[model samples]
Target: MTVPANVAAALPQYDLGAEIGRGGMGVVYAAVHRPLGRAVAVKRLPGVPASDERMSARFAHEARLLARLDHPHIVPVYDYVQDRGEHLLVMEKLDGGTVWSKFTGSGVTPAWSCAFGLAMLSGLHAAHEAGVLHLDVKPKNLLFTAGGVLKVADFGISQVVSEGATLGTHGGQVLGTPAYLSPEQALGNPLSPAADVYGAATVLYELLSGRLPFDGGGGALAMIQRHVHHQPRPLVEVPEPLARVIMRGIERDPRARYRNAETFAVDLAGAAAGVFGRDWLLRLGAPIHLSPQVAAATTRPTATPPVVRETLDIPVRATLAEAGTTPVRLGAETLVPAARVLAPPAPARWFALAAALAAAAMIAVPLATPGRDLPVHSADLSKPVTLGLGDPTTAHLTLTAAGITLADVPATAPDPADPNPAAAGPTSPLTFELPGASRWIVGGAAVATVTADGKSADYSLQPVTHPLVSIMGAGSAVLLLFALAYLESVLRSVRRRRAGTGAVVVAAPLGFGLGVAVWLLASVLLRHAPDLWPALVCGALGAAAAVCTVVAARRSALR
Candidate 1:
């Protein structure tokens, strides 16, 4: 192919090499500073008319705008020069490809997406302080260095937002990627730094939810119309705190978003810390494996960064579904994402599914004696009764009879969990004694009833827990809770297939205790005919509590 005149032009001071990258407005060449011998990427601004004062002014203005910004997250300009009628900008050469390249194959996660937002906004915040608005803020323009540092790039289409200011060659027109365009910018109205914030938020929503906010698939004009009138999908599908911050950023009215990029960063920092610990941010970027073509385009040798396997320990309450399921590896040569394997179904489930697990253990430990059977005890007269086993479990009654007196018991007498007075201490092979010519059935097929002198009193009973039964019950419950928690995590994963939510680092311990408690309460209240029915009812309640604990945390009540 013939060399274009713009590419052939000589700038004697800098040595330009092969064209490594090309875009609509210019071609990027690997260049070196002649005197300093420093490597840089030189961008040639082509198609400028020699007599166009406005274009000339815009070129010079672009130089000044790029020169003023000084932030680690921004691609810095090294030199600006004009050769013949062509203009060129020498900038820091990034060996790691654009953010766009990373997402084309393996998808981006929410934590890393927020991490990019934090870094990208820092640059935008600096630009706004310098009075410039990055009209185009999309994934294609965001770049990552070889060190995995994400930077906001491509200010060629940006403009200064200062009053009555005309800085670049955009010429007062709609400027930005169509999919991420702000409502005001799409309408050809004046731009603000908030518009950039809107653009950044759109990118975040896409990462977190895994779909374009409004993907009408309509061409350019249709996109502008949609942005002007249509609202994006709800962010509620994602986890809390993080979702709240994103929704505010993409609000249709600029006034509703964080007033400045700095404010938005503050909110973002809190959310990233809440959902994914602050130290885990690096893991988000480490999973991305750039294509060889993208890496070869850079100025240096590329080594695919090691997949960060450093397990992100999300405090049980703070995090949700993890991306541990097999990652969709791009190709054999391309590196796979971090393997986030969850706690495999807990060992508790093997026993939890059957009531006999606990009942059998209870009987086995207490020593079964061919099983004794007794008739149902019932009476129509006032009476008192006492029931006992090898171990003592409190029996609560609605009426005072014999040595049995109503005594108040603490909700957690045995350490904050025993809310039933009826279960004072009744154990295996229970025996019942009735007073005042009344009848009582203890540990029998019949519900214990005491009646005397044409008066009757009945009381609901707490399961007479054995020491072994309590130990085994607790173990079974923990496993049951784990199974429930894992199910919840799976549900969240399916729901957030678009966005990569974190994993269940520590299954909700508090929720587990609550689930066991609910199960106990339910079992006591459900004194059904078949022994299996009561156990099944209580188990269902426990499972519900475990699942709800996770669902309630991920979902917002107000939303």
Candidate 2:
């Protein structure tokens, strides 16, 4: 798409060149600062209507917050522009390609991957400390300078988590890429620093193993489900200690994972030193900056002789065809384990419980309690007419034969400077048109539809979402979660050769109380929503609680 006229006019100082990148967030262009004779990248956000004060404020706030980050491994923002109808961020430009382009096929060493992870995690930590989250962390966002130094770029989707609010997501849609999503993110639950660490771990895993942890054949939703329910495939031909560090970062439960990026970096450094020697980073010759704690951890001397391995044949992208019995050596004299033994499969009992819960939800959802019909409302379309007037949560729609539009009511009074008072009213601040035969908005799980013909319209709310469904779904999910948690505890006890009778005794009442509490909470919060939202919220919470408890129990068991 061509740049809008306003966007082009907004950046007078920069000579805009060819488009360098484009994605859902916005478009990026290569530009040169006319005064400084330096190249920079300009990211242009889509135009916000003049009336959209909320969005305008949000855009300006986020842009300024991102510009404050000044770490060596982070791409520095030079300036931010908010013109008549455009938003642009100007940042320093690097000529070297992305990390994906650099190491996709070439055989790079474990030392190299470790060094890369250190730098990437350090950058991520800096952002975290500054209350910014690089929600979208992937190889494509890892850019290299001409000198081969890696810098984390593209904070396009990064959210400023200040106080307790963020703009990471719009509506209910997921924001980050599907492949790198943490379990909490995949479930649309509240996010924490662990999410970025998960992304970093996924990247490190792919760089070393040449495949994603959950690289099954599927679309985005399927991939998300896998991350929620499946254990990652064991790392192969990687040093045992390094693999453990990576695995902990990618844990399904966010709490079980690294709490912050620096902790992950420290663990990674120690693991790298154990496998590659204390001076591994120095030997790799990569400009990886580590914190003092991490540097101190890395200084712990290794018993093994220092080995610097570099070879064109070292598989940077290990594939199925490369799987063999040959031991992966670090250098001429160093040796480590050939592969990590496969982790035992998940207990069958847990799978049975999950499958049963899945079956029950599938059967009950289609049979949700029917909705009560609200009074049928009519609108006179000749003048601007508001729909769903009393209920402010739903969108105010401007219906037309072409489609429907989401509009806000004009701020109470007319503009005094207008030529004609009749046409003096302002348009909705958040207005967008969609072309279709019928346009519908969902509240909870129920759909509200307004049909227009020429000048008049009629609308009704469908009864798809009801309190009964919410209670049923929420109660079931909570029970399931608690049941799994109890089972995990019992399983852990059994593995340790203990009786575990306490878990069995407390499971029923604990599950029942938790389920009832969740059901009541959901009923109160989603009373008006009346559709799918109650169940969805409860399910996301239940899944999060269940996974955290189970994972924690399992880890405690191992200990």
Candidate 3:
């Protein structure tokens, strides 16, 4: 085989095989470690000039960042070597395809969608924590492992965030994949982890609907304009709860969206759990089942065509041993064959139903007793509480208590800009610190202190988030949600005389019950401190979940 100039350097350590993937950055070749015989993918950056100082450092920075991150969902980097001035980024070879490579017109199921989101979120969360930001997040950037884990890949345009500094120092001046750019990013404004949130949400939206939220047939510039100002098409195909989660995640206002990728992921997992419970991940299963068209698209020549399409390893150990001789489903949209649709276990179904009934019973029984009203206005908030603030993050809150001479509780108040969400809304604002808001935004510290009479006093203050309200409201929400599911199942079963209809009917309530039950318990336990921001957040979530029940039932009926 004729070794390309870029492929020569890797030849010593890695037996470079056929080219499997290519992009504007460079071509990707399959290579086997000479000593270990481990399969890997080596991407040689043809665009990065070995002579350019800034570009070289930037590329090196990206390589170091990826190498530092250790997460199952983020692809690991084995080595970054500039073989003769041509940068070669050797990575743990993934066999599953990219999400875009196998995106089918049929769209992704809710369980799979949430699972994929969770995997991606887990990776992004790790990146954010490590002070790295994935500026370009899109379907193409997400690769699946042979085992079907969605791994976040491609930090080509990523940058490191300095401690306490919320803004990024790299990739700011340049545009990344325009389709997934956050509104703030598109406008060329300062960015935080929230920008990545928008990108993840965008790709997830595409995965769920099998289409881009903002379709820009008009052109790239026009599409950028739409991304900046456009409202996405309504998500009626998905269950309403899932739809609301997606909508909120992609909110135009960064604040309106989940504070970070973590929150976005939690909601997705929560909603999926409600529908699929502990078995949600299983429901998503794996994806090697690619339609011929999608599989073909991955390998087809383009202006910047990838050498490998969906590595079935759909982009993997089984990475096309022979590039074209073997039809490899290289990248995955994370869609398994429809034949593998595993129905919920019988015991799981019953367990979900029983839990739902228990919740409903709790709510119903409480209502019959006098003075059992939920506590909305009443909550205990007399104690002082503190949450941890990591490096580059700080906190300051004024404590005023008469007769309780306070110790040096910083006379300074937390920044108004970084107001506590729990302090204001019916829900407590999630504790998220922006890298850009080090000097201003006030975040809760991990350790809080409230001293009496100029000395530190022992005290435990719970968030005044009204635990009664949280519990009672959660119970009521779940009860209503279950009722809606049951109604829908009944209607759907009657209309569709298909075989195994009873199982479908039973599964509807069970899926919804598990989801609602899990959500209820999580809400109650997590909101024990009684923060308003989360309450409001939970309220919005509840409404969305309820709406999902109605829409899902209606859609099932129509189907």
Candidate 2's TM-score reads: 0.55
Q: In angstroms, how far off is 379's CA in candidate 1?
A: 99
Say which candidate scores most in lDDT: 2
Error of 2 at 323 (Å): 15
- Determine the backbone clash count of candidate 2: 7
User: Poorest 10 consecutive residues of model 2 by lDDT?
Assistant: 335-344
- What is the full ranking by TM-score, best candidate first? 2, 1, 3
- Pick by TM-score: which candidate is best? 2
The better-scoring model by TM-score among 1 and 3 is 1
How big is the positional error of residue 204 in model 3, measured in Å on the Cα after superposition? 1.4
Clashes of 1: 21
After superposition, which runs of candidate 1 have C-alpha atoms over 4 Å from their true positions? Answer: 1-10, 48-51, 164-173, 282-559
The RMSD (Cα, Å) of candidate 1 is 22.8
Which is the better candidate, 2 or 3, if ranked by TM-score? 2
Predicted candidate 3, C-alpha RMSD: 29.5
Give the Cα lDDT of each candidate: 0.54, 0.62, 0.55
